[model samples]
Target: MEMSRALDISAAGMDAQSMRLRVIAENLANQDTTGSAPGADPYRRKTITFAETMDRGTGQPEVQVKQIGQDMSDFTTRYEPSHPAADAQGYVKLPNVNNFVELMDMREAERSYSANLNVMQVTRSMLTRTIDLLR
Candidate 1:
């Protein structure tokens, strides 16, 4: 039962990291996305927040995605007079998403997810060994 609890906790963590990875992926995918109309706002980068929550049944602390919010940081601009999204000044607003930052976040989320998966695997192995011993 205790091992089950560990698995549950790890699963929650993995779930949270999975969501984070998804957000990062989306940011990367939309790095070039821009508004179709001139002077319209471009795509905004998304951010994920994690919070520790107490499991109702086990009372164990587990990570959860608190929110998936937009990054309000200023969007980058480039002079592109031919672009459809170019403003009156010939400057086009770009998405705030940065490839480097998104890649880094993706790496971190992937590592976290892998770590949680490892914990679950180890816990399952221990449970199996215990059952074998009991037999």
Candidate 2:
């Protein structure tokens, strides 16, 4: 029963990290995305927040996605007079998504996901060995 709870917690952690990875990917993909019209705002970077909650059935704290929200940071501007989204001052607003930051976040999320997967695998192995001992 404890092994089952471990599996559940690991699964929840994996799920949360997967969502984080997805959000990071989206930010990376839209790093160069600009608005179609002049003076329009570009795509804002999205951020994922996680929270731990007790699973009533298992009485274990599991990770969950608390929010997927936009980054409030200011967008970078580039001098591109010919661009369609250029403002009156010949400056184009770029998305707030930073490739370096996104990559770092992605790496962290991947590592977390891998760790959770390892935990699940170990738990499964233990359960298997316990069953073998009974047989």
Estimated TM-score for each candidate: 0.97, 0.98
Which residue pairs in candidate 1 have backbone atoms (N, alpha carbon, C) closer than 3 angstroms, thus clashing?
Answer: none
Candidate 2 lands at a TM-score of: 0.98
Error of 2 at 121 (Å): 0.8
Evaluate residue 115 in candidate 2 and report its C-alpha lDDT on the 0 to 100 scale: 96
User: What lDDT tens digits, residue by residue, belong to model 2 across residues 6-101?
Assistant: 999999999999999999989989999999999899999999999989999988999999999999999999999999999999999999998889
**Candidate 1 off by > 4 Å:** none
RMSD of each: 0.7, 0.7
Best by lDDT: 2
Off by over 4 Å in 2: none
State the local distance difference test value for candidate 2: 0.94
lDDT for each of the candidates? 0.92, 0.94
